[model samples]
Target: MIGARLDAVSEIAESMQTHRTSHASVLEMEGADVTSSQTEIHHIIVSVLSTIGRSPDIQRGLTRIFHRKATAAEFIAVIQAILIAAKQLQQLCIIEDKSTNQQRETLHSVLLRKLISIASSSTVINGAAKLLSALNKEAADRQDLHNLFIISDGKFPEVAEGTRRVELANEKLDSLIVVHRKQLRIHKLEYTSVAGITHLIELPLNTKVPPDWVKVNSTKKAIRYHSPEVLVALDELALANEQLTVVCQATWNSFLTGFGGYFAEFQAVVQALASLDCLNSLAILSRNKNYVRPLFVEDDEAVQIHICSGRHPVLEAVLQDNFVPNDTDLHAEREYCQIVTGPNMGGKSCYIRQVALIALMAQVGSFVPAISAKLHVLDGIYTRMGASDSIQQGRSTFLEELSEASDILKKCSANSLVILDELGRGTSTHDGVAIAYATLQYLLEHKKCMVLFVSHYPEIVSIKNKFPGSVGPYHVSYLTSQRDVNGDFKSNEKMDHISSEDITYLYKLAPGVSGRSFGFKVAQLAQLPVACIQRAIEIAAKLEAAVCNYTEQQIRRSCSLSHRQDGCKNEPTEDVLESDSLSSGRVEGLDDISELYRELFLNLNFGFLEEHGDDRRLQFLMQARNLAAQLIKLWSSGKSTTRDLWVGHTSWFEL
Candidate 1:
């Protein structure tokens, strides 16, 4: 129940923030300055409704009504307040009849007028009247319903009779108090009530002398007693009060029961109020932030999104003037997929999010945080971002990431806008790249949606080759110093590694792919141990060199094979001989240990051992022991490097 209420409130808030202000009449307003009228309307809305929006009481009441948890009193109060505001807004919209010229109605005025009409409708008026008539006039006036039912014989005879009896009982109690005061000869003596026991008289301990009086309690200074007449009155009062409570409860239940007929009407009023609230909110946001209205393409047009100088609405608010704005352009007939690559913390995610947010704000009819925007209305916005594992569901982080990606693939269409950030980063690099690649291919070739993809994997950028003109590569531009002339680290060292001090984030999107993610800089910024960083750099460099060597070898071998196929029967070239010599040297270096392992495994006849029993098995075991001893001895002497020994070999036990 609480979740449902919260969801309703959230929906209301979102609607208010993004409610579009466009109307045909406003769009077609002639001889009137539309922008100025809009500004004036925003000012009026802010002035009229800002206080109500900030009132927690009003907001809570509205939320209750929205969720149908409100009592008649609560519903009446909230509707009364909204109606009062609507009237005030209506008066503001009214132009004097004395004016010679008529004023053209603006969009804001039209919306305000619509709100007033809804508030003043017969349904709302009759419902309010019925509720007020059923409630006590004084309680209704004060907007308090602690005593809900009207104590009138005409409206609720049972409640009225119960009330009369309670009143008469109270009068009888008062009469007894007067009699007791006169008899005690103490005019100031009054009834002392404690813990709901009413009409007990207190007197001096020595002065009490009535046998008919019942002793209630006594202290040193005073003795308390209830006269016989007072006890009878008290009992009548208690019974009358109880009866009144039961009657009042029944009346209140009946009142609510009758209200069910007006539930749909009141619900409509609540919806109108919600719309009014959102309109007012949107006006305020647009006026304060100088947001521009976005122009949406017609349904017949091709899908497109073009934003000029767009800024992230949230980040801009937080960053103020420091937030940098960037442009976005995508079209189904042109570059529909943007592969965004940049260093960590370079604002890649922020840029994509900005684009998505602007699109969403535009579609929802809210002014976007941009200088200008023109886009086809996206049918849906799909995003797969961040990383999380569902432990309770027994799913790993990679599984969750892929699951979201899979859902996106299944659901997204050509008219949708998709944002994927580092789609497959929760697993191995090769697998991550493969999954990310396949996902992008599916989106481009099949879904053909407008995609803003962020990835650290450089290899995924190659998808542009298969989908030419539709895929565009971009990077969040940044500046770096303390690098070689080629804009990289020294050739012998890691090419992408850079100290945090040497890099500066520009936070602007630009063309072309980023060479590296500059993750080491991020690690440095995170304050990882210096020695650990250096060791990582060393390991990274070795891996990079090994990969480069393997690639070069493969290319050369392919080239040689091509040349041989072309009927060249000449001596091997220097490059070929060098490659052969390099390859043969490693093999020759590990030949001794390799031969020992070959003899130890290949010479053992398993079938003969089983038939000959322990005698033949004993000989094979002795040979295996000698081979293991020789292998350990060779390794200890470091006759060959471990890399060379393992380069072309599997396990030593393999025959």
Candidate 2:
């Protein structure tokens, strides 16, 4: 009966044709495939109402108010009447069905079972066991009266206080369980030809069976064997069941008629949920004082990200069970990509992910974890920091990293923010350096997106020199001291335990480069082999010396070539003489700017120098020396005015 009602609903839904939004259309398409599940509840309603029709009093009452015709409208009116009656009985809804394998039956059936159990304990009727006997006789004698009864007393059930029947119904519904089974069946088949060959064909439905069966059976035993009230309650339930059948039958026809109008809309909504295209379904959560996104003004200027004390909402939630989250600040005007360098487990990954999450919140149109936020909408956000690899896809970890990075490069625009963590670690040192360098250059020079790069490679620090003032470094602080294990000389381990005051995790943008990678302390914390760590340190020392030696060799060769040119006959004698005088009188070999310039251009003829160049460079150099002398004189004279003589101007060019 339930299956027939569902089929009818499916037909009605299929016949519905109307224009729908993208979201709505998808929902309807999904619903059409499984309209049976939704219609079952409604069908139960029709069945209940049909059972109610067995009582002459209810029939008379309904007929007086509803049209006499057995049309769809009359069916709905009757269903509504039953619903109203149920509502007045303090029940929200009802559904009945066969029991699942091990789980109880549908929500309504469980509720009916509970009600029957409770009613049997009442002390109201006489010879209650005989009540079922009489009802079964009546039902057999008059088929229409099988489950019908009239509540001449109109008394409501009595049980616990403040517990509405509707509330109980909802509770039972909440516990409704569905189980799925995991099973696979394989089939072999032969091809069939249209004209010549007669072939075997195999069709597989892959028909699913319950993975885990949930059957519904009361934990309750019939305790009213000798109680009269139990019989009275059984009689009431029997009558209620009769009314239930009539209601369900009527509901089925009503659903068939009206379902055509609403089924399409309902289906579209379901499909939308399945595809996760509800766009507005995602939620944003944060706990910070700064905004995570760019804000746009009415005039169209964008609001920059100025997150202070900001953190990743997901990370924070995870950490809440253990450690505290550090606060951070990211601003467009002051910071774009922050080169975060620190010891391992120093929170670099956490910081980068937090920024990405904040941006994600903004793109999806949600508030971020900050005190106050204004965001310019972003197109999309990309994150590439964590470890994920698929060997089945024929990609190594490094290859996968490069693939994701390449994809990001192709897709990210100026409005996107890219986060990279220890990129290029899957290759040789030189190759990794080259890749890291080129990747950063592309992000800065081409992509022009907001970026946060976390790396252990020190080579990236050279970027400050290449793109002066464009790059800045921030490091996590650790303790350092002067001590030796044997009390003879200073030990490197003294710097291992950095003081708390230094671990600002300050998240502040400051000038200068990160000090050093505290990998030793980190290794200690991780309990690495001490011998391996010492070997690594020894290798690192050798590598550093080799690099320095190579650099010095290049500088010495260049210096030799310059000196040979300096001693030529056409040399500027006066500038050379000045440099010699300064060198002779100065501390060590440090020369003032003018002296260095004189030494630099000693071979050039004075006439040629004047003809080819303006005096701005020469005058500026001379002025710099004069300012330095004045500063020294003031220090000796203990007078501030002596220094004031060269207040502003290009004097600001001092290193």
Candidate 3:
């Protein structure tokens, strides 16, 4: 029977079309392919229920009601027995698919009623009272009839409690057995229980015995005789016992008929119990994991995901306290788009995935792995993270990336969360950067959604310049400074080893673009050939220098535009002196505003110069000092006021 039910359910599930937002009717997860063991469980339940239907032990008990033949205690016992036997488990395939909160609460109320009926002497607990009331009515009617039969031990039997009849004929028969015992001067007078007769065993020949007694068995030293009078008593006892049993069966049959009305409530109580079990497990898990409940924003509120120190759930479980937590603040306004870049193995992927997982957890009504989180309901969470291609379906890595990206672009809205990692990475660097930049620009302008785009391509940071208000740059930080292990691995040596400089991963997320991917160092650590590693490093240096030189040229050309628009009288200095330009004394006629700005700039520039050991940035600082002087000279010479000069500034940093 259960197999047939499973087949029917499976067929219906297969025919239904799956939707992203479909509720799957009680979380059946119908088409998700439940395990074979669950199917076997259904079969076992069917067998158990079938055995219950065939059991004769409960047949009379279920049919009979607790009349005056039993006390209130026995009545409660009988009801409890029936409950234990009649109840069956509702199918629960998975934890997430249990009944709704409202349903469970309703069932909980029903269970409370059942408990009250069991505990209270009064039979008045809603649905439960109906059956008890019916039984009590019948019990009152049989109050006088109680004297018609008597239980032998005065209590219900642990196995089977049989009613004893008090008919006059039965009393007479019982008295006859006593008479036989006294009169038989036979060695032993015994009652044959199966034959329902009194017999005399080892009757003495010298003793006065009734000649009417018939010989039943003869032994060498003992003779057994059955009395005709005992046979008549046995027949009377059998008839009396049979008549009382008929009334007992009638009472049981009436009880079952009334019980049918409340059976549904009992089944509902079982379902509620299962739901409570799940809740208890969740409570225990929450306590152990230190998970906090997520706060969901109201429907009218803006879509936002603001998590404080949210850690990756899976990594936190595996690494425990070692996992570094990070904050994720996403809104449709300023924090709409973020470009995360970092060195290899710096936990960039982990950071973005943690945010996604937290969002997913919050939407599913589970506590997230965060100190605190407030999130708005999202339509969907779209991830174009890892490359999951299907070569069997003739799809390459790039094609798969494009397909997923295309879907995200087409369907994602402002309420959706988009996570992309290394988009266009399968292509050449030139084409890949262009594609990545365009995609970033499109998402910034059109999608206006919360996006975490992680990539090794530093050029993608250009979007932050374009949409500085919303798009931002972030990186998982690392301690690049070299450290020694017991002062081993000489500073000058270059052999691949697990040196701190080569393999230190901080797993910390910070604002701004990440540094180089450290691919060559990673390769060296992987034990690549020494000569090839050296050759790769030499080529990488040339390529980096060429790109830096080109970028610097573009910046220099752009600075002229700033100089022209800043209202400087004389042509701006062609370049700043690289060596000790700050050693010169402060220029006169500079207002407090210009002087304060210059001081702050010098402090930042000098700090960079000392830390990076880069002379080029020092040169850039010199240029900035010269531009400040020019602006101050213009403000003092009456070409423009300090206010207009600062206001009409052409550089991006106009406050």
Best by TM-score: 1
Query: Residue 31, candidate 3: how far off, in angstroms?
Result: 49
RMSD of each candidate relative to the true structure: 13.5, 26.2, 20.3
Clashes of 3: 7
Better of 1 and 2 by lDDT: 1
Off by over 4 Å in 1: 1-44, 47-80, 90-96, 100-112, 120-126, 133-153, 172-197, 200-229, 483-501, 542-655
CA displacement after TM-score superposition, residue 105 of candidate 1 (Å): 6.2
Q: What is the TM-score of each candidate against the true structure?
A: 0.69, 0.43, 0.48
Model 1 steric clash pairs: 16-278
Relative to the true structure, candidate 1 reaches a TM of: 0.69
Error of 2 at 42 (Å): 32
Write one digit per residue (lDDT tens) for candidate 2, span 99-193. Answer: 43343322233332333223222221122222222222343245442122222243211211112333444343222211001122322222222
The digit string of per-residue lDDT tens for model 3 on 1-655 reads 2222223233222222122234444256553433322333334234434544443333333334322344433444445433433333222222233444232111112332233233222321344544444334344346533332223443223112334443666677667667887886433565553243343444554556688877776556656666778666667667666665666555554545546665445544434333333333443345457777777778788788899999898999999999999988888766788788888878988998999999986665556688999888888899988877799999999999989888999999988999999998989975777778888788878988889999887767756767877987888887554446675534523323322454468888788776467787778769999888878877876765665564455245324334244543432233323222322433333345555355435433332332223354454455565556555655676644565646654331331
Clashes of each: 1, 52, 7
Ten-residue stretch with the least lDDT total in model 1: 603-612
Q: Which candidate wins on lDDT?
A: 1
Question: Model 2 reaches what TM-score against the true structure?
Answer: 0.43
> Which portions of model 2 show Cα errors greater than 4 Å?
1-257, 263-299, 318-335, 363-365, 464-470, 481-483, 486-511, 541-655
Ranking by TM-score: 1, 3, 2
lDDT of 1 by residue, 309-385 (tens): 99999999999999999999999999999999989999999999999999987776677799999999788999999
